[model samples]
Target: MATLEIDLFTARSDNFGVLLHDPETGRTASIDAPEQAPILAALERRGWTLTDIFTTHHHQDHVEANMALKDRFGVTIVGPGSEADRIPGIDTSVGDGDSFDFAGHRVEVIETPGHTAGHICFYLPEDKLLFSADTLFALGCGRLFERPAEVMWPSLLKLRALPADTTVYFGHEYTLSNARFAVTIDPDNAALTARAQAIETLRAKGRPTAPTLLADEIATNPFLRADDPAIRAHLGMEAAEDWQVFAEIRARKDRF
Candidate 1:
């Protein structure tokens, strides 16, 4: 199996644009074309040509450069079928449980529709990599823009059920701010405290705190800790359903 090489770079403020390349087949894809300049630059730096684009949602920031890149490289644009009307230049539409082949690798689409009614995430089982997009962030999850917390909580749990070693790449650089809110809720978490310190150090040095491991997220990310007894206890929701606990956490983050 050929290893997937990922190049992650910042685009348009806090958004992250990622390029996934397969060395063996020389096929490359952009996870989301948040902007044309950075995505094009990353492709140029690696001497790779963009052949496909995997869009997670219909948000303008995530798809703003899709048409530009497609016109330049004639790339195939893949996005959620649920939001086909909203995604520009989308050639292929997929929903949860749909699987497809990309540059000799299989990609699984997981529908996560809290942030948007049609949001989806890509999971590459072969590489153990997940492109979580806006659904799940470092220490926090995306705000419930199109659906209620009840709907979004299950989507998060789905991502959390992936292999422990799965490398998670999310949409933005909100880890530092998320860490601040996380500590306020789960103050006694030693792992979270350590993770918070590390996030601060990385931010100070101008580093990206993404591509985090699912194991670490499960251990430290408060959004993913809804099932944790400690978190429930702290929230005084010991008897609450997992989704209820999750809703409270998300609500707190909204106001944080």
Candidate 2:
């Protein structure tokens, strides 16, 4: 099997559009279609025909160009089963724990329902890559729009359990702001301090800070550090349940 080739590009302000291709089979898939123009240009540039679309949720920005792209390419659309009726061009619906093959690669669907009630993430184990969408981000997690922090925390824990080296590809380019907020919550964390400085340099250059390593997130992301003694102590929730600690951190971020 040939290694998967991934192309990451900007679309619709801060949204990141991704294309995944299997070089051996010449099969390609777009992670989300925030808009049609850039995605089309990307495909044209690579000369890769889009065979499928893997949507993470029903958010308009995430699925706005679904129909246009599908019409243009006649591609297969796959998305969360819970939001099948809501997604614009869904053809195949999958839920948590479901496994499907994409050009000989096994993709696992993980139901992550915090950002939205039907949000899902795609994990390709062989490649150690996870398309987290809006559920998780670098140094931050999605706002609880449709679910409570308690519900969202468990969803994050599931992702945390993946191998430390798994590369996480999230939906937006919110790292710079997220890093700033992370420092406020984890003021004493030396690792976070250094990470924030690095993010500043990247943003200064107008570069992308996504596809972050899971290990770095676990080490520096406050949302993923609710179990860490230092973070729990800073929140004065050392004796509180992990969920309680998570809730406090999320509430603080909301106000930050």
Candidate 3:
């Protein structure tokens, strides 16, 4: 079987709203709505009406445009059940272990409550694609906002356990900035150097460094390498908890 066609829309500057389509069944759904104009324009360009909107969290950047777009397109809004109260206009509330169909594709909702108490990432096992909100980023993870570092660590581990082939579509285009910080701590990481160079090249051309594969991330991303001996040693801490490393990395990024 071939992978389902996933079209990415770079809406609201750095935020990305994805479109999942299955030509066989002619079904299409969008992942999130950070802004209204760009998502509407993308849908119009493809002549596709928004059938469903899956929100990862209640962050304004992720769900602010939900009502405007829903009213404009008559779309079904789905969001994390744990955060239904915060996610405005959610018609269907989902939780961990829940599954839904989109264009003949089955998507599993993975509860990742670190970026937010209700943050949930949609995972398509068949396609090995994870619409990881702000929980897991290219070179870093989202800041510990409403939750503590310990609470966020397990959430990110859930994502790291997925198949390495999963294509991670994150919420922001903060790669270059994050990579710069990663190199400072893991200066000997040849992969990080290479990826930084590539990212620099891509950004210089005004290109997007998105839809990055999880496999590449595992090899190069420091946030996902808390267990690595090299990283543990560099942190000047032994027997450190996963969240400790996560905290260190996030703290560094904040200062960087």
Candidate 4:
């Protein structure tokens, strides 16, 4: 089967509105609905009818347009099973390790519950695409609003184990700021320093850095590198477990 065509645009604030279209079936799915107007405008631009919504979590900014879009396009909304009660207009509920179909491709649901208790991410193994709304960002992970560091660290491991080439589509545009913080934690990483310089250029040009390579994130993102010796040493936790190191990094970020 052909991979789904992707469309990404800025929505309310820094939120990224994404649309995935299957050319073979003429069916399109919105990764999340942050705003009604932008989504409608994007659909109009591509002349694609909205067929479904693959919700990542129950955050307001990520799902506020759910009912409106569903009402207008009669879209079927699929969301995390654990937080289905919180997702507006959720028609189908799925959880960790669940796989569903969109067009002829398999959409694997990975439950990442750090940002929220029932937060999830969508991964298409065939296409190596991961819609990691709020769970994993370009250079950072989401804040733990509903869970703690221990719970979130394992959730991150699930994503880390994915293919290195997986193209990650994050929900927000905080790469520039996250990069600024990253250098402080993993200062000696040459790859990270180079990536930060590039991000600085991208932000200066007003470009979006949503789709980052998982390999780059693994090499630089402090939250994902708690097990790395350099970061653990930076935090003065060389003997600590990975999750404990992650907690220290998160604590520092919360203050940063």
Candidate 5:
């Protein structure tokens, strides 16, 4: 009955480093290696040895410590197959709809390409945990760097379809800024206003705002509410498609 042990810690200026350990099988994986020192220190403190690195994308900030930790522990590196050529030292290439086992738990790979053309998310249904990387954030989605809002909206739907109880761990600590922007677009939402106020307190206390519950994000995150009538009215896109609303929101955020 032992469950997965997740070690969440801060690394670099805004990155979060997550280590997943299975007590039953003694397997450990770093969701994405943001920095070498922090990953190693977290493992050292937990007394867990690294056996795998499940990479979410080709971004340097996410994969910077891949080789360093791999060389240190000889851990296997798993990454997106579509970006295999770009990912450094990828030993396993997995794609969208592909899944694999991690210490008896099923790891579902979802291709979310707006943040990066090959950015992926790892969802563990049994544990209700999602390593969202840079795809979906607390109150905002990742900037449309590699794809347009049309493509990103569908990618987000893949996550929004997940169980409400799922606990999400994202790549960066961008919640406070995201919250600031969210209140502007979803001003009429009581849930969002309250959540934004709480984010202010959380950041003031220097607490991490990540590992947010999917249910909370669904209720308050404007990015996930493009189909909601209130937000559509706010943007004067009452009859527009969901992605169009999403595009307007993204553009506003970029300018904000």
Candidate 6:
């Protein structure tokens, strides 16, 4: 049998909320809740209803619509173990290595604590799709708001270790801005130049540049390329520690 079908819907200005459907069982799971209208509109268009919600963290933009959606559709809300107390209407609380079945597809939970103490990413191994919340963006990463740079480093490294082919669906739509920052880090990276041009073309056509593949991000996104010798040398770093490189890239972004 073929892998399940996944559809990505960009909600609000920069958020790309995802809908994963299992045809075998006719079930659907939404990755995040940035707003209710987009999800409602998408589901109405597809003639499908939401059954489950997988939250990555407790951010308002991500979780604010949870209750409204659950009340409207009676969907089960699943979130990380660390934030169960804070997440409203959580039906199931999970942690790293936890696996659950929905619509005959196995979804594994990965603990990625950095952006938030309880941030988690959903991994569908069969499909090689990772629903990276704020932990990993297309060309940029979430601001180290709740945690220090030290905590976010390991979390990012874990996501980077996933197979290069893994398709990443991040939480926001910051690719264009991120690509602008990428050029400063690796001015000589041909991939970054090409990616910026492609992104600009898409934006000009009013299209979204999202659902970036991990391999492509590795090629252009400096955050995921912490271990690359070229990036390390550019930052004047010695060790290939993911956090060390992460710190340098993040510091530069803050000023950029």
Please give the RMSD to the true structure for each candidate, in Å.
0.8, 0.9, 1.4, 0.7, 0.8, 1.6
Clashes in model 6: which pairs? 14-173
Off by over 4 Å in 3: 1-3
lDDT (Cα, 0-100) at 44 in candidate 4: 96
Please give, for residues 1-256, the per-residue lDDT of candidate 2 as tens digits.
7789999999998999999999988889999889999998899999899999999999999999999988988999999999999999899999999999998899999998989998999999999999999999999999899988888999999999999999999999999989999998889999899999999999999999988999999999999989989889888898998888999999998898
Candidate 1 stretches greater than 4 Å from native: none
Task: For each candidate, give its TM-score against the true structure.
Answer: 0.98, 0.98, 0.95, 0.99, 0.98, 0.94
Question: Which residue pairs come into collision in candidate 4?
Answer: none
**Would you list the C-alpha lDDT of every candidate in the order shown?**
0.93, 0.93, 0.84, 0.93, 0.94, 0.85
lDDT of 3 by residue, 1-256 (tens): 4356777778776887788767666566788889988877877787777778989999999998889978877888889998999987899999999998877678999998877888999999988889997988888788878888788888888888899989899888898898888888788889999999899888899888888999888888888887778887888856887778878877887789
Question: Tens-digit lDDT track for model 1 on 1-256?
Answer: 7888999999999999899999988889999889999998999899999999999999999999999999999999999999999988999999999999997789999999899999999999989999999999998899999999889999999999999999999999999999999998899999999999999999999999988999998898888889889899999999999999999999998888
User: What's model 2's overall lDDT?
Assistant: 0.93
Q: Model 5 over residues 4-50: C-alpha lDDT tens digits?
A: 99999999999999999999999999998989999989999999999
User: What TM-score does candidate 4 reach?
Assistant: 0.99
Tell me the tens digit of each residue's lDDT in model 6 across 1-256: 4467677788876788888877766678889888999998888877777888999999888887899999998999999989998887899999999999766567899898878889999998878889998989888888887787778878877787889999888898888888889988887899889998899889789887778899988788888777778878888885757677888899889888
Candidate 5 residue pairs in clash (backbone atoms < 3 Å): none
